[model samples]
Target: MKSILATILSIALFGGFNDIATVNELKNRAKKAYNSGDYEKALGHYIMLTDSLGVKDENITLNLANTYYKLNDTTAAINNYSNVLSSKDRSIKTVAHQQLGIINNKNKKFEEALSHFKESLKADPTNEESRYNYELLKKILEEQKKQQDQNKDQQNKDQNKDQQKNKDQEQNKDQEQNKDKQNEDQQQEDQKNKEGEQKDEKEKGEQEKKKEQGEEDEQKKEQKPEEQEGKPEEEKPANQDPSFSEKLKEMNISEEKAKMILEAMKNNEIQYYQQNKRKAKKKKDPDKPDW
Candidate 1:
């Protein structure tokens, strides 16, 4: 213990110690702090040593990564662990891969975690932790893929259902439009028929009136000329006698005047009858049926 203390004191006197011995002393101090669970002290010492060394020692980088992980500084831990992957030591590379796999799994990067675990196993095939984690991550990836496929299928089915619904709606709309068009056409046809029927009835009525008028004209043509002349004959009293006395009484005249007027009328009637008899004889047919 006293010799160890003497060596430490010699290393601390920077001017007396060689650079290699000083660096070894720093590494030893950092490792002692880390083993004692004084991660903050170990981290500070390692940082100072890395700056002095001007090189990333594999062991120091690995210890820094572990310290960062313990401090819950995932970004720093991941960066340091990645640097440790370049170490020539297979053990260090295996541990780095394992830590990276654990970090990626925590971040929900299952595929990347699986890949890291596989790389860890390749680096050290006897790493039980890496092998177990690899199998577990593989199963998780498979389950995630299956879940994604189910979601995709469900989306496709929903899309198809929506398309079919839209198609049916459009079809129904078309059918309604056609039905309305058909109704309009039928209404127009009915209106046309109604107008035609009314026109036919008016024409028929006019024709009947014309026919009756024609029949009346023909009847008038068949009548005697005198009858067509519209002359009205005097109506004599059925109970009266055609005598001079009766005529005088009907005229309310004196007997003498009535006798004189009757004489003049008799003369005029005799002359009119003679002229009419001559006209009738002149128009007599030579070839005749006596009936």
Candidate 2:
């Protein structure tokens, strides 16, 4: 590194002396600014050396990549680091791969970062930092794979449980519906039986009423001999009063002497009534008291 810088500084030829001095000055400023944590200043100086001055040195490109990384510009940093990867210098390859691994790791590209770390280690077997990164990232990926498998198993178990719960709920709902239907059917059957019983009772009551009315009508027919005979009687003579035979029939008398005795009793009752009427007529009001 010293030999190359000495050779470049020693070449103070005609047209390129000023350019070479400017490039060296920019390189010194960029290095100092980066060491002092002034990434913006370092980025400006490095950009002038690499882009403006057109310095094609891989070491300068590596320095520019480092400056960009310090400025948190991972895109430009990765671009410069990738350019350094083609350098024949094993140390530069190691650094370029290590920087890419770090950038990829920061962006959570674990696989690419691990691959870069492995390449960094391959480029320089003594790079303990890259080896550490490779081992750590490998463990992290393995743990992630394990966790993913466990999560998938748990998710499957939860899905099966939910399906079984839903099935049980559906069965319970069906059972409840069936039970309600049975209760409704039973209620309808009970209602039908009750209505049938009520109808039968109503018909029985009507039959009893008809029976009672029929018995009353039979009694009335028995009392009225004409209606019992179902015909009008023949017209009689003008004397329509009860005859002696009817009287005898009323008295339940079969002998003619008993009928004569009933007639004598009737004549005596008439005489007694006439006598009582004459006594009532003789009963006069008392005379006014003599004053």
Candidate 3:
């Protein structure tokens, strides 16, 4: 660090013209080289003036920037122009800002270029070129901003339309789903009702069957006295019941058929009695004769 400081101090303190004649001669040669369009030779002379001679001259710095710009060394030109910005001479500062604006404009930096142009006009307001550049760039930037806003508005409109369409589609889908669900529920309820109806019919049929059996039992009880009438009080026939004729009447037999059935039953009784009488006659007395 100390070495760097010492080197800087050495150049600043001692690297200058010891006499006026040598300095004037170098200045004439640099000017002549620049006027002849020999930028390389002019650049060498300018570097000698600023770096080797350590002349703190703003004009030398500005000229160096011009030469670098002519050589298409934009980085070096910008550095030199920035260095001249702090100059006390308004003409030099205005020229620096103008050059910087031109460089930035070529690189498509509209805002920065316009700012530099405005600064250039502030330093030298009577310069018509700076005024024109500032007005033109400002108008261009305003038009660009307006176009961007219009495009943004159109884009928002399109997005809103798409969103509304999607919302409507979703609503329709939900409505369709609800309709299908209702249909399914109704079908299930109908099936359940049909099953309930079938069960009720089956129960009704069973109940009617039980009722008919009860009525038949009551009818049989009511006919019991009729079947008992006209029977012998002493004894009943062995092979025939008194209820037999009633059974035949209940079978829808004609009156003639009922009499025939009664006659058959009476004949069976007579045969049974004769058989018992013959058995009695065959029995021998204990005190009577034996064969």
TM-score of each: 0.66, 0.53, 0.62
What are the clashing pairs of model 3? none
RMSD of 1: 10.0
Model 1 ranges with Cα > 4 A deviation: 1-10, 13-32, 53-56, 230-291
Per-residue lDDT tens digits of candidate 2, residues 3-66? Answer: 3354345444423534666677667877887899977777776666666567778988898899
**Candidate number achieving the greatest lDDT relative to the actual structure:** 1
Model number with the top TM-score: 1
Candidate 2 error regions (>4 Å): 1-55, 148-156, 194-291
lDDT of 3 by residue, 97-211 (tens): 9899999999999999999999999899987888888899899999999999999999999999899999999999999999999999999999999999999999999999999
How big is the positional error of residue 70 in model 1, measured in Å on the Cα after superposition?
1.4
How accurate locally is residue 128 in candidate 2, as Cα lDDT from 0 to 100? 94
What tens digits encode model 1's per-residue C-alpha lDDT throughout 169-271?
9999999999999999999999999999999999999999999999999998998674444333343433355585676678897777855765677677767
Better of 1 and 3 by TM-score: 1
Question: All models: lDDT?
Answer: 0.81, 0.81, 0.80
Where is model 3 more than 4 Å wrong at Cα?
Answer: 1-32, 158-166, 212-291
